[model samples]
Target: MQRSYSPSVRRRRLSAQLRRYREQRKLTAAKAGAALGWPQQKISKIESGEQKRLPAAELDKLLDLYEVSGEVEREALHECARLAKERGWWSKYKSAFPGGLPDFEAEASAIRTYEAQVVPGLLQTPDYAAEVFRAYRLLPEGEIAKLVEARMARQGILNKVDPPDFVAVIDEAALLRKVGSAEVMRTQLRHLKHMASRHNVDLHVLPFAAGAHAATSGSFTLMEFPDPLDASLAYVDTPTSTLYLEEEEEVREFASMMSRTQSDALSPIRSLSLIDKIIESSIEE
Candidate 1:
C-alpha cells in the first residue's frame, strides 16, 4: 500500500532533502540563491518549508542544480514536492482550524494524547463535537456545524490503510462530565470502547484515585512521525489559542509527562470497565 503522506510531513522531508543536497555541494543559501537568480531568504524559506508551495519547474531546477541523477531518487523528491504543495483535507474548511492540527494529525505515525475535561477530538462523536463547539461560544451556529464537520474529518486518519498508533489517557472527570445529552455521552463512551478494541488504539483512564498527576496542567497531544527525519511536535490547547511546540526539549518534556501520566492511569482493561460502569449509570438514570 502506498503510504499516505500529510502535507506537513512532505514539506519537512522536502526541505531536509534540499538542505542535504545544497550542503553536499558546499553551497551556502546565499550562493545557491545567487546561482538560481532568487533572493537569499527565499532559499532559507524553501529549506524551512515556509514557502509551502514549490513550483514543479523550480523543483526541477533545484534537482538539476543538486545533480540528482538517479531516476528513482529524483522521482521520490518530485513527489514529495508535489504533496507538500497540496492542501490537506481540512484546509478546505479554513475557518475551523486556524492552527493546522489536521496537518499534523494527517501524517503522524503515532499520537499520545491526554485530555482532562472532555473526549479527545479524534474520538469525539458528531453530536459531542457540536456541543463542544457550541460551548466554546467562539463560533456562530452556522460556523459551528462546519467546524464539527472538519473535526470529524480529522478522525479519518484512524481508519486509513496504515493508521497511526494512538494512545489516549483521559482523566476520570472526562468520563463523568456531560458533553451533549445523556444519549450523546453514552454513544461517545460506546465509541471509545469500540475504538479501544482497534489494534492501533490504546485507551486509558486516569482515575480520581490517581489524584494530582503529571498532566494536571491540561490537555495536550504529542505527535510522532514514521520518518525519523521529521521531528516530533507537541500541541497544547489553551482557552485562547493552541500552542504547537517543536523545540526538542519542550517536546521531550511533554512526551515524558505523557509517559508518567500513562503510568498512573488505569490499564486498558480496567479503563473499559470504568467506561462500562459509567455507561450503565447513564442508562439507569
Candidate 2:
C-alpha cells in the first residue's frame, strides 16, 4: 500500500490541469488574476506548482473562472490539491535523493530506466548498493549506512500490492563489473533474476556487441503517471546536480533513447540466460 502521496507529483498534476483549463478558456495568467483580483504571480505560481498551499476558496475561484462545472471533475482536482500538500516516507533521508526521485517514483504508474555502468537502484541489493556508494569515497561509514537504508526503504514500492511497472535496460558491462565480493555479486545476480521474474518488471541487457548506443552519455529514468493531466517526468542525475525535465520535447528524447536501447538489448528470457552465463563463467569461487 502507498502510505503517502507524492506532493511534488500531485502538485504537478494540479498545475498541469489548471494550466490546460486556463488555456482552453484562452485566458492568460495575467488576465485570470486581473479578473479574480489576484496578484499575477499568484496565478502563475499556482499554475506552475511553485506554491506550497492552495486555499480551497482560491481553487474554487479558478474552477469557476475556467468553467469547470462537473462535480466529479472539481472533486478530483480538489483531491489532487489536497494530496499536493502531503508528504512521503522519504522526508527524513532527503539528502540521499537531492533529485526527488522517490517523490516521482512513489506515484509513478510506470518507470523506465537505462543504465550504462551500474544496476538500477530499485533493483540493487543492500551490499551491492553499499559498495557503489563507498566508491564515492567521501561519505563517512555512518552516512554510507544511512544511504543504504534509504535505498532499501525505497524498494518498498516494488513490494506494494499495486506496484509500478518497472523496466530496466542495463549495459552488459555493469553486470560483469563486480561491485562487492564474488559472493556479493552472486547474491546480487540471483536477486536480479528473482526481481526480473516479477510480472511488473522487465529487465534487458545491452550486450557489448550492440556497440554504439543512444544513452552512451549516461543513465536516466522516466516515470509515467496514470493521470492524463500529469505529464511524464524525465530524471537525469549528474555529478554536480540533478535535472527534472517535464517538457514533452525533452522527455521524448529520453523515451526515444530508452526505446532504442531496449531494441538492441537481449529479450527478457535471453537476458536471464545471459545472467546465468555470467554467473557461471565470470563469477568465480
Output the TM-score of candidate 1.
0.90
TM-score of 2: 0.94
What stretches of model 1 exceed 4 Å from their correct place? 1-4, 64-67
User: Across residues 78-150, which tens digit of lDDT does each residue of candidate 1 receive?
Assistant: 8988888777667798777878788888888899999999999999999999998889887778888888888
> lDDT by residue for model 2 over 1-285, one digit each (tens)?
436589998888889899999999999999999999999999999988789789788999999999999999999989888888877789899999887789998889999999888898999999999999998678899999999999999998898888999999999999999898888888999999999999999999999999998889899999999977778989998888999998889999999999998999999999999999999975444
CA lDDT of every candidate: 0.90, 0.91
The 10 consecutive residues of candidate 2 with the worst lDDT sum are 1-10
**Can you give the TM-score per candidate against the true fold?**
0.90, 0.94
What is the alpha-carbon RMSD of candidate 1 to the true structure?
2.3
lDDT of model 2 at residue 125? 96
